[model samples]
Target: MCHTSGVSSERAAHLLRLSALFQAAPAADVQALAELARLRTLRRGDVLFHQGDAATHLYVVESGWLKVSKLAAHGQREVVLHLSGPRQMVSGVSVFVDNARYSASAAALEDAGVLTLSAEAVRHQTAQSPALAQAVIAHFAKRHVELLERFDDLLFSDLNARLARLLLEHAPPGTTLLLPTNSELAAHLNTVPELVSRKLGEFYRQGFISLERRTVRIVDEAALRSLGGP
Candidate 1:
């Protein structure tokens, strides 16, 4: 991890504006936050923060991707919770909670740039700005709805349907898509890598997809769409 002071006020403000939680914030509050923000760079695979770490700062991705994950209760497996890209937040929502710690670990999926802001400063600003508080509430409401949808999928959908949906999300018909490794996919799908590989092989044999290295090419969109369902 490396920190740089070169993030200009304009860039910082722009990044903040992109976040739904801060997009409606008062200009003065935004400016104040811009001044308090710093840029941090991460190498691929670098751990940004471990689960249970003090939530001292909120992170906003400026470029590349970050993976949010948590280990299983037995401590023998990890589950990928979310993947955040540019303009997305990693710990912004969690930082506002009293005596908060990160609920999950965050790591770089690729070389990335992130903006960091003091959680204390954000709390102070929110206290002084009603508009900021309203924005935070709206952000949480939206996140809640999304979580509900994900819960429904996990509860009702089978692994094959989930895998199909994942592939279709990343690739359109006849287009090759670069993907994370099998282990990463399994982690995201809440399955074992062997099962993921087996599913891919089945899809290949069925003429639904083709795999080369870490890339997959869709061969039968209709079949996958049917298998994946609505």
Candidate 2:
């Protein structure tokens, strides 16, 4: 990770500027860390790592999307932690963990490019840069809050409410909802696939949505919003 690629300092700084994680680092630190990274490309569905894999790199999404997910006990099912888009950093905490093993897996949700920085190099940088250390701490703290928020939603919100909100956010009228399958939705909503299927059927019966193979057509936005109770 500490090895240099012999990249131009100008190019290094430009890439550093583009990454939200490193943009605020000192100029010298930016140049140093950038030299320690290499670029990688991934096609849709390519896995970056699996749970318990050695957390050797900090991946910065330069373009397209990635999904972070975890498997249930016995690997019976998987649940998404988040969908990371361009400019987002994945596994910032992985660099600092004592065991340095990824708690979740990451995969390309679409064709993508990422800057892979050596975790050892990043940890060394963090040792010298208080700002980078603080930033890493903040990233973990933010994800902690997000996990709690998701737990709160699952505990307090009804299935109708959760499905309603998801539809409102991702699948509005005239738009085809993308790759999230019923199994994925069930995993996200903390419910069973059969339950999700029944709910979708209920929505269809109520004229709130229409379904086709791998897609949901939003039909009644206002009614769906009403179903998403606060």
Candidate 3:
């Protein structure tokens, strides 16, 4: 059972501030959408939805992190998706598709908050706003393109190269990068933690990088680039 009573007028107004979902929606449509949503908070390690569970609602993260993963045939869980930080839309594609069950399970990486809108409510709002419908379609299309790129990277790039690229892209603009834990880094890079740690050690020995706990400092950016090939 989920709670929906904490969403006051202020919180409801803040929910309407989600630009991604209601970018082109009219004021009335935004209000209606917000009204139809239920707010829920999740603690770290909480399972928001399990694989094959009915996908009744789409989620928007207001804060914290969520990881979407699926169990492989080998009895290991593989993280295929991640939503870190705020204002992320979760599992929106499944709402319009024929599949009712969740394709992957979503778990809280940290204490998080989310607003969930029923599939029927989303459909009703989209039906009333053509712009919203088009926006949603475009959002899904962009996500598909991103997934294709990830597939290409995994197929063609080596583990070290992939890890380097991920670090550069996600790292803040600074001299040192605060990398995730080895376990979390493994999931993000689609590999095992032991392998990731080994690669980091190799990089350190080669004088190309330095690792301190979860922080990774790129000592030689040029060498890092060379590992990724031309």
Model 2 C-alpha lDDT per residue in residues 16-109, reported as the tens digit of each score: 6776677666777878887776777788788888899999988877666677889989998799766666667888878776558999998876
Indicate whether candidate 1 or candidate 3 has the larger TM-score: 1
Q: Where is the poorest 10-residue window by lDDT in model 2?
A: 1-10
How far off is residue 118 in model 3, in Å? 1.4
In candidate 2, position 44 carries an lDDT of 78
The TM-score obtained by model 3 is: 0.75
For candidate 2, list the clashing residue pairs, or say none: none
lDDT of candidate 3 over 79-134, digit per residue (tens): 65554446667877778755578888888766788888888788877887887778
The residue-level lDDT of candidate 1 at 124 comes to: 92
Pairs that clash in candidate 1: none
| Whole-model Cα lDDT of every candidate shown, in order | 0.85, 0.77, 0.73
Q: Of the pair 1 and 2, which is ahead by lDDT?
A: 1
Off-target runs (Cα >4 Å) in candidate 1 are 164-178, 198-212, 215-230
For candidate 1, the lDDT comes to: 0.85
Query: lDDT score of model 2?
Result: 0.77
Using TM-score, give the best candidate's number: 1
Point to the candidate with the largest lDDT.
Answer: 1
